[model samples]
Structure formats: C-alpha cells, structure tokens
Target: MKKLAITCALLSGMVVSQVWADAASDLKSRLDKVSSFHASFTQKVTDGSGNAVQDGQGDLWVKRPNLFNWHMTQPDESVLVSDGKTLWFYNPFVEQATATWLKDATSNTPFMLIARNQSSDWQQYNIKQNGDDFVLTPKSGQRQPQAVHDQRRSGRHYPSVQRRRAG
Candidate 1:
C-alpha cells in the first residue's frame, strides 16, 4: 500500500509538471522566433484600491541576446536602455540617468523574458494564462505583477509586454 501511494504521488507530480506551463509555451513560441521587435505601450499605475495614480505611454524596442530601448513620452519622459551588458535609466524631468548592471535590473523583472529567450529565464517565474495574457509571478512569491501579452502573431511584431507593479 505504501509503495502504491508513493508511486501515485510521483506520477501526479510528473503529470502536473508537464501541464504546468500552460502559458509558458504559448509565450515562448510566440516570442522565440523573433530576432528584433518593437511595440508601443500604455501603462496605468494604481493603488491597492485600483485607483489610477499615474499613466504613461511608451515605445519599446528590443533585440535578442539583451538589447532594448524603452522610451516613455506621455505624462513625463524617461528612457531605459540595455545593450547586452549595462542597463541605463534616464529621467529627463529629474535630469538624472542611472546605470546598473544588466543582470541586476532583469534579475526578477519579466523584461528578462523578452530580453533573454532561454528556458532558464522562464524557469524562475510561474506563468499562468490569465484571460488573453499571462501573469508572470516570481516563484519566490514576490508581489511584482507582470503581464506578457501574447497577441496574435504577425511577423516580427509580437504583443507588447505590459506590467503593473503593486503599490
């Protein structure tokens, strides 16, 4: 009886593992083919009560093996750039530009999903289908909420990845 129970538990875990990435493959297949891409994005920041705190529109450009330009133009102006090594964030209003190592910036951010097209990148997060998009939450149970939009495929232009961090 104990042997049978152990086998059942192992089998169940195996089955769950195979079916766990319902959204991972979908997102991977959709984005893996592209070498470069760009998308326009609109972001809304809200509080716990869902009240809008800030809004911004931006253009995102990315290339494989870590390279992207994130430019925000609406409500304010800021730019984030990564060139396969260093990451830079510039705020024109504040007249400040901060630079950091690429690894540090994308360590827990879903931007790694887009920047690094590797199985290892997807392994750190749990991706589950939420409606038309997928919500990527850290496996460590962090509160960072990120959405990888997998819109219908059309050449190199895939769906824009939008994320909302909880306040």
Candidate 2:
C-alpha cells in the first residue's frame, strides 16, 4: 500500500509538470513563427490602490526582425509605436508626444513584452493558458530582454530579424 501511494504521488507530479512544459513550448512555437502579425486586445490597467484606472482596446503590429507598432484607439487616443530602435508615445489627453531609445524603455511591461514576442521558460516566469488567454506570471523581478536591431547590416545597430514564411 505504501509503495503504491508513493508511485501515485510521483506520477501526479510528472503529469502536472508535463502540462506546464507543454503550455510553455506551445507559446514559444507561436512566437517563433511570428514575423509580422496583428492582434486586437483590451487591457485594464489598475493602480496600486486596486482601482481600475483605465480600460482600452488596441491593435498590435509586429514585423520582425524587431519592429513593432501598437495603437490604442478606444477609451482615448493614445499611441505607442516602436520602429525597432526608437519608441514613440503620443498621448492626446496630455497633448504630448515623447520619444525614447528602445534600450532605455521598460521591456517588461505586459503589452510590450507580448507584442515584441518575448518568451522565456518558467524558470524565469510561469505561463499557463487560462481558457483562450495565456496568463504569464513573472517570477520575482526578472526583466525581459529587448531585442533591438538596426535596419541595415552595419554592425553598429543590430538589424531586426523579420522572419518570413517559406513559400
């Protein structure tokens, strides 16, 4: 009886771990194939006080090797578009447009991380499919890397790799 119970426990653990690994690998596969893709999504940004401050719908465009453009059209007119080297943010409410180097920006922000196709294993974070959505939980303070490449092959700027589907 004792041996049977131990074997059952070990098997259960393997099942759970396999499930998690499969989910991660699936997500990675999606990222690996994303050369230029578009997705529409709604995001609810909450504050530290636990109040929902803003909600909006946006479309994402990613053209690899490393170019991404994101525009939020609902709830307000705001935009964040990155040309693989520089990121631009235009907020109509503030009547301001700010630009910064991609290397200095926050790469770990949820939307940016996903749009840029940053996929790491559960050792750095956990990824699970919640229904049709993939819920990614970052482990502690691990920051996602920003893959910023140059436009041309000059060696000074890392050229963004745009993965094209084979004909």
Candidate 3:
C-alpha cells in the first residue's frame, strides 16, 4: 500500500508539472507577439496587516525587444526607463536619477520579465492560472514576500499594465 501511494504521488506531481509547462508555453507565445504596448494604471498597496499604505497612478510603455518606461504622476512623481542595456530610475522629488546595467538588475522583477525576451528568464517563475488571474511564484523555493494578482484583459494571455498592481 505504501509503495502504491508513493507511485500515485509521483504521478500526480508529473501531471501538475505538465500543466504548468503548458501554461508557461502559452504565455510565452503570446508575449512574443506583442511588439509594443501602452496602458494607464492605478495602484493601491497595503501593508502586512492589509492597511492601505499608498495609492498612485501611472502610465507604462513597452517597445520590444527591450525598451520600457513607466511614468508615475500621483502620490509622488517618479520614472523608470530601460533601454535594453541599462535601467534608469529617477525621482523628481529627490532630484536624483540612478542608473544600472540591465543584466545586473535581476530577472525576478515583473518589469524585467516584460522587457526581456528570453524564454529562460520567464522559466524562472512558476506560473499558474487562478480563475480569471494568474499567480507567478519564483522557482527558487523561497516564499513570495507578497501576493501579485494578474488579471488578463482583452483575452490576452499576459495581464495588462492596469492589472499589474504590484511592481
């Protein structure tokens, strides 16, 4: 009986892995077809206790192979620009702009995933569909510090910028 139970568990694990692989492939194919995208967004962030910490609005622009810009207009003004090779972060209130090599910026970030076209990078996250949304969890075995709910719009596999509430 114990042997049978172990075999059943292994089979179930394989099934789940296959399902995730299919979802990831579909998402990759859809993302590859998008050459440019623009969207306006409103974001609300809460603390661990679920208290509202910040609310803001922004606009996002992405021109693939790898150009991205995010302009935040409310709460505080800030801009993030990536030109395929480098990432620049600027805050008007602070009068400072910091620049870093895109390769060094880490692939774990959502914006990086959108800006990067490599399939290997996308594979770093385990993606699962949840009702009308998708949940992405890192494959590194570390628990995600926060939850990100991705709601697909206009029948696209990837969530629109408006639905990406967490950065």
lDDT of each: 0.79, 0.58, 0.69
Measured against the true structure, the TM-scores of the candidates, in listed sequence, are 0.80, 0.63, 0.79
Error of 2 at 36 (Å): 0.9
4-84 in candidate 3: lDDT tens per residue? 999999999999999888766666666777777787877766554556678889888888866989899998999989888
Report how far residue 43 has shifted in candidate 1, in Å: 1.6
Ranking by TM-score: 1, 3, 2
lDDT score for candidate 1 against the true structure: 0.79
User: Lowest-lDDT window of 10 residues in candidate 2?
Assistant: 158-167
For candidate 2, list the clashing residue pairs, or say none.
64-161, 64-162, 65-160, 65-161, 65-162, 149-158, 150-158, 150-159
Model 2 over residues 25-104: C-alpha lDDT tens digits?
76555555555666565655555344556667877677764577778899987898888788899998999999999767
Clashing pairs in 3: none
Candidate 1 weakest ten by summed lDDT: 150-159
Q: Compose the digit string of candidate 1's lDDT tens values, residues 1-167.
A: 99999999999988766655767887787677777888888887666456677888989888898999999999889999998899999999989999999887777778777778777788888787766688777887665667777655543446666556576
Q: Which candidate order results from sorting by lDDT in descending order? A: 1, 3, 2
